[model samples]
Target: MTRQQAIVADLLHACAHPAVAGAALFALSADAIERARVGAARRRQSIGAFVAHSVADFARVASERDKALLARRMRGAPAPIVAGLEAILENPPRA
Candidate 1:
């Protein structure tokens, strides 16, 4: 597998962590992972660090209940974006 794919797989495997073992495995393309790698490399970060930060970012966005942003994103957005938006709508974050 490519390095990008390996990063994603490692993130999936890391889901077994006790605190987040219940978290669902989100799918991402190798291309997306590669983009993240490029970004990480630019910042002199490791691939693993980049992937972990990305997953955390996704979780943060999914937890945010910003309706205006969610509504704007719903128009012709990708599946992952839509899922994040729905997650926000269904479960607004506690203050």
Candidate 2:
């Protein structure tokens, strides 16, 4: 696999691990923290919930973009490969 694909595969594997599944921790810049805090307050959600939702939304969009890229790259592939990729694009796994 290409470097980007390898990195994505590693991240997917890490996320699937029992200890890390559904939970993650990472540091953010002070500015970003303050912004998220304010946004959360506005939405009547806790900062953690807001950040989780935001991250989920971002992942969903990124997944769509990746699918689109895959579709473009599959333009001249064999029929079976194209069909398989089409199925995957149509039925992406739930986050």
Candidate 3:
């Protein structure tokens, strides 16, 4: 896993309840995570993985939640990445 992803994983695992530690784990709100999960599920992928790719790419995300989702996805990426995450949803990553 990438450095960022590993860090996130640490945070997630550290959580008293990983499932409930969305904000600290990913820097996103709970609702934002839900939206990201839904988006990923639509494409048949893991919410975590989808977030990893999106954040790694630094795409033009919409809300703070998107950013948070990206952080969460980074955790345990490639293992269960979020699915159906659309690149076109926001601006492309910076050069």
Judged by lDDT, which candidate is best? 2
Residue pairs clashing in model 1 are none
Tens-digit lDDT string for candidate 2 (1-50): 65445434444344334234223323343555565567669889766565
Q: Which candidate is the best by TM-score?
A: 2
The per-candidate count of clashes, in order, stands at: 0, 0, 12
- Arranged by TM-score, best first: 2, 1, 3
| Candidate 3 to truth, TM | 0.34
lDDT of 1 by residue, 25-68 (tens): 23434455455457568868655555445445544553323433
RMSD of each: 12.1, 11.8, 11.4
lDDT of 3 by residue, 1-95 (tens): 76665554444343323243332326554565766677568867666554554454443333546545656554455533221122212333444
lDDT of 1 at 33: 46
Rank the candidate models, highest lDDT first.
2, 3, 1
